[model samples]
Target: MILIEDTVISDDVADKFFVCNLEKCKGACCVEGDLGAPLEASELPVLDEIFPKIKPYLTPEGIKAIEEKGCYEQDWEGDYVTPTIEGRECAYALYDERGVLKCGIEQAYNDGVVDFKKPISCHLYPIRITKYEHYHALNYDRWHICSPACDLGKNLGVPVYKFLKDPLIRAFGDDWYKQLEREIEEK
Candidate 1:
């Protein structure tokens, strides 16, 4: 799948350091964009095998994304929403903990689809690291209800080097990442 290139992008991963005060914001993250984070081409087969039986039950966009293995099939600048699961109008159409719409994939996993797991990007939140100049930097992109888990500074006090590298390895793999590692490290 082709990654929708974002030239102007967030420097750090948005990790939820604390369980976001989501109730206050009411699951704003779910409405923000595609709920699932980036997935590797290698991971396509897993969903292909599972989505068919459940395809009709999924939202039209969700089904299309599964087929393409591309999350943002269209440019989701904003203004998108899903039909209420039980009864409510959430853009992403996920359940609310009392009120706020939660991630659709997470809720789907709870309903069933036991094999469902978070994408590598989702697992590593607010602590996102990307190649910036000669070095890597940690960024707190969405501090609000978007990614409350991103503020790891409290426990870790800071996002250490390994935190950045491990996820990069998972996202890009050993060889591709090694190139990036060399680019940043050796210079």
Candidate 2:
């Protein structure tokens, strides 16, 4: 692990490559996970605030899940996460005519409905974060469903850290990301 500021980042972030192949995976990460996308405590209010704006874009089941279970739910691990539809797709997930999973909150943000673009966890996908009393842990999550993305990323020579620049910046900060890049380059 490489220590940057208060965070310990896994070497896989720089050693492994990954780029989402939406056509191949069909956004399986959003739909196949055992639980909904994890949410930071601070994000609960944002989810609530954007629920109405994204409601129209969600599926009927998703809307009902949100209405009945609230915008977020606590998992067995005691982590707050977005509500899922029948314990499957995320409540905020929508699908296009092609059946590809999409995030309603992100769509709303793109359409200028809200400034927050979904959850930071969703944005920093494949890289799950765990907070500790002293620092945070950043690790890459490998899944069989993402093999196509791994192949594509390898062919394109984009490492996970490089591929997720925007989200890393969103999760940490500009300075932290710059420091990480510098450390990677120095190595």
Candidate 3:
């Protein structure tokens, strides 16, 4: 199985072309929740180690949510959203009275308590990496699920959905962008 990884979608790549009002965006991806990721076989040990620390509040519903692995195409039966375990959102989700996206990961990064320490799955939103043959197709994760912050950044200016949406294309030059997009279409 080939996995698509995002390396170019970060400000490092988008910044080369456009400035981002990340604060303005408010990190809606994290706010939207859906932060729980299934523990891969290799991740089990790490999660097991961390479980005790976080287990007090861990719920069966939260565990079930990861198993569902719902995605953009997953059936969302109306009524606001289909029934989901753990409310199908990130653990750090919150909104101000005005309703804006706020992410704890970025806040932690800004506060210097943590830096680039979030789960890769959490860091890579609106972006993913899928491998094909010997090459990888770096792409954005555009599920159209977000708050006004993401909506504004995506439409008004340059903003990479993920920290590493694609390997800095500059490292590979313009041709890499075309090549990655081509992989997406083919797949």
TM-score of each: 0.44, 0.98, 0.42
lDDT scores of the candidates, listed in order: 0.43, 0.91, 0.41
lDDT leaderboard ranking: 2, 1, 3
RMSD of candidate 3 to true structure, Å: 9.5
* Candidate 3 or 2, higher lDDT: 2
User: Which residue pairs show backbone clashes in model 2?
Assistant: none
What candidate 2 gets wrong by more than 4 Å, as runs, is none
Q: Rank the candidates by TM-score, best first.
A: 2, 1, 3
- Candidate number with greatest lDDT: 2
Please, what are the lDDT tens digits per residue for candidate 1 over residues 1-187? 1121221223233222343445565755545443334444454455445555444445655454444533232225342123232222322234444865555555556678645544444545544545446554444455455443334443554332244556656555677545544443443
Candidates 1 and 3: which is better by TM-score? 1
